[model samples]
Target: MLRTQIIKLTRAPIRSFSAAAVRTAEGDTGGVRSGGVASSDSFNKREAASENKFIREREMETLRQLKEKLRAQRKHLDELDAHISDLESTKGGEQN
Candidate 1:
């Protein structure tokens, strides 16, 4: 999922580089020129992938914690509602 997002974000940059390379005569003329682009792009992609993974993991952890908190809150609300209903019924009995 994160890979898909990163690729989508970097697609334009990658395409622009490809287009420029095709337009330049010296772009692929030498071994060093070709290898340099490949190496740099590979390093950049690896770094981006790692960063995305970390972000995703952190988001998942936060979501899990939030869910647990919401569950506990719901339970507490239910208990309060039950207690209020019981008190109201007792008061009605006394009035009768």
Candidate 2:
């Protein structure tokens, strides 16, 4: 199917969290009545920290991939240059 081909072509991963779960957590904290603000603030801080960690990990992975690609491209370029030099040398010899 067309969808299958699209999935194969895409390499990026998708992540999602449900809003209902978040609302439920807030609702539970609200039901506690006492220390609700403190609890909410703590929960929010934890959530933010988790998101930040995930972002950093994804960034590191992307950077790692880019570094690997750069190394491969550099190696290919070096090989091409060497081939060109070889051809030039052969041509010079032919001229003489």
lDDT of 1 by residue, 1-96 (tens): 999999898876534535354354664443353557788678668988999999999999999999999999999999999999999999999999
Against the true structure, whose TM-score is highest? 2
Backbone clash count, each prediction separately: 0, 0
**Which segments of model 2 are wrong by more than 4 Å?**
1-34
* TM-score versus the correct structure, for each prediction: 0.62, 0.63
Model 1 vs truth, CA RMSD: 16.2
Candidate 2 versus the native: TM-score?
Answer: 0.63
lDDT per residue as tens, model 2, 1-96: 999999888968666766454356443534553567788688778998999999999999999999999999999999999999999999999999
User: How much is 86 displaced in model 1, in angstroms?
Assistant: 0.7
Give the poorly placed runs of model 1, Cα more than 4 Å off: 1-35
